[model samples]
Structures are given as C-alpha cells and as structure tokens.
Target: MLPLPESLRPSAERLFADRLGLAERFASMLAEQGPERGLIGPREVERLWGRHILNCALMADAIDPSARTLADIGSGAGLPGVVLAIARPDLTVTLVETMQRRATWLEEVDAELGLGLEVVRARAEDLHGVRSFDVVTARAVAALDKLARWTFPLVADGGELLAMKGGSAAEEVDKAGKALAKLGGIDPRIEQYGVGEVEVPTTVVQVRRRAQGTRKGETRG
Candidate 1:
C-alpha cells in the first residue's frame, strides 16, 4: 500500500472506494512497469502517487457532468486519460498518441486496468475531421499556441479544451490569444483546479469552441 499525502488521502479514498482497488493497481503498474518500459522516468516512481496519478485524476473535477466523451491528445503513457477513466467510469475516453510504442503501452495499460478507453494511434491533426469530442485534454504536450491549433478542431461545438499546465499557465493563455482566435477558440482562461489532494493547485487553461455560425473576428452589423 503506497502512502498518500495526508491531505490527499481522504479524497483518494472517496474517489476510489466505490470503484474498487483501482488506485492500488494503477500505482503498482506505474512503479513496476512504467520505468522499465520507459513510460516514465526512474525518478518518477516515488512521485507517481502525487505527481502523476493523483494529479491526473484530479482532472475529473474539471469535466462537465454531462460530458459523454473525452479525447486525450498526445496521451503519452495515458497520463490523464487512463487516470480519468478510472476516476470517472461514465466518461468515454480516447487516448490519441502518434507514436506506435506509446499507443501500444496505452492499450496494454487499458487492458490491464480494464479502463475501457480507446487507444488511437494518430496525431491530433490527423483525427481532426474523422472524430470530435465533447472534451479534449492534454498535459505537458506543447505550448498553448501550437496546442490550440492541433486540438481546437477536434472539439465539438460548445465543447472545451482543458490543458494541464504549470505555473506559467496564465502566461500561456495570454500568448495563445492570436492562435486561439485563428482556431476559432473563445474564452481562453486559466482555471485553478484540484481535489485538495496536493500541496499546489492544478492549473489548467480552458478554451471553448464557439457555437456553430458564430465567427471569430466578426460582429453582427
């Protein structure tokens, strides 16, 4: 049994209790196989509970209760994608990774965890016209500007892109303005999120897609 930070324990218990022993199983896999397979760094094993798993699981708090499907772009090692599925079984998650090896690892982890998430081996841009999602999630993937270009097209009308970022989250949002405008993204703002499970709050930049027929840089005249 891995020890969780005292403040985070209760929340973890609540999140996992009804779901079975998911937390434990996920921790074990990450610690044992994650490093060996190069899915995570050797130094990351000790921090998996706090930095990786719990952090990603907290993303569930940002998801809309009515959201049915979520796409995790650049889902290397399934970060938030796998964790979110375990935390919220009601969500249909798709893990999109351009690397075959990473995609394979996602599939393996999904089967092992029985997460029921779909693993798609393609970059976000490739899937733009083929699929759309109610929510798009990304973490440590790219700068907000480039990320917006790749992800905004995949968001269903009225859907949102929730990107996990570090302390520079606000700055990223500011810099992504022009890119967002070009991509038809609206309301790009930084949101403080988390379940009180970690010492620092989770920072996310949320950008919503404009509803159909609404044009960016246009006014009803």
Candidate 2:
C-alpha cells in the first residue's frame, strides 16, 4: 500500500474528516490493485495521494451543498466519484463506465467501502434523455468540446457539469464555446480548489445547464 504523505495529512483530514480511514483504505486498494488491473499506470502509485486521491477529494468543495445527486462519467478507478461519495455521504453518486473491467472494479470498491454507489456499465452518451442528475462530472475523460457533448445533456436543468481539467482548461473552454452554446450551457467558468493545500490545485471547468423554459443566450434574471 502506498503511504499517505504527512504533507497531505492535514488536507485529507480537512476533506474526509471522520471518513479519513475509509479514504485510507480506498487509497490502499488503489495502490495495491490499480496498476495490476490497468486502472492506473504504475507510475501513478507514487503520487496517488497528491495527484489522485486528494486531488479528487478537493472537488467536493465546488459541489453545491443542496445538490443531492451526482454522476461521474468514465469513472475509471472512481477518481472523484468514489472520493466524493466518501467525502459527502449525503450525495447519491452513480459511477458510469462503459468498460467492463473498470465497471467491475468500481462495483468491488463500492461493495468494499459500502458507499452505495450505483455502478452503471454504459457509455455516458447512452444515458442521454434516459437519465439526468443534479451534477455530472468527469475527469481525464476527453477534451472540453467533445466532453460537453457527452456530459452536458446529463446535467439536469439548472444543475451543473463540474469537469476536472488541467492547464488547458481555459483553452478547452474557449474551444468548446459553440458546443456549450448549442447545448444550453451557460456561464461556463474555470475554478480552482485546494489552493495552498496541495502542490498543485485541481482545476475545474464548471458549466450550468440553462433552466427549463430559459432560451439559449437569455440571461438569468
């Protein structure tokens, strides 16, 4: 098992609080099984705490306190999905992955952690029109334009898509402008979390779905 660095201990405690042990166990599972299962690269094991776990845990801060449902698309290794569920027990999280092996691993983690996650083995596009959630998120999935096409429809009216991104966040958002406009996404913005806690803060591109009856390009009053 990869050891949680002391440097990250305070951030972990701040994010997971009483659930820190569960986070530790999940980290152990990932460190032990992730590379062998192809869920994460072998190189990732060394920085699992900073680069993966805590990086994901901090996104919990961006989530709306009133949001009750969330879905993580392409939730391979359950980055923010499992991490969010562990952090906010109040949320009903669904992990959506098309790959059989990754979905199976998610199920195993859910069962092991008793997180009550709904693991769906289907592509994010498949759920369009069939299901929606208060918040939809994805990490390391695809570039912003294509990702918005797949995930924005899953965002319920007035809800948001909180996509984890990298330095290219602004570039991606600019590139996705047309797609966002057509998809009824409004006020797209980039935000960072865990500043001062981690060596690098997590960058997120947040886009809210226009509420029902709101026309595209119409400002909210």
Compute the lDDT for candidate 1. Answer: 0.83
| Count of steric clashes across candidates, in order | 0, 0
Q: Write the per-residue lDDT of candidate 1 for residues 76-188, one digit (tens) a residue.
A: 87788888888889999999999988889888888887888899988899997889999999999999988998999999987889999998888888889988987778877
| C-alpha local distance difference test of each model | 0.83, 0.94
lDDT of 2 by residue, 1-221 (tens): 56789999999999999999999999999999999999999999999999999999999999999899999999999998999999999999999999999999999999899999999999998999999999998999999999999999999999999999999999999999999989999999999999888998999999999999987677565
Provide TM-scores for the models.
0.92, 0.97
Candidate 1: pairs in clash: none
Clashing pairs in 2: none
Task: Output the TM-score of candidate 2.
Answer: 0.97
lDDT: worst 10-residue window of model 1: 212-221
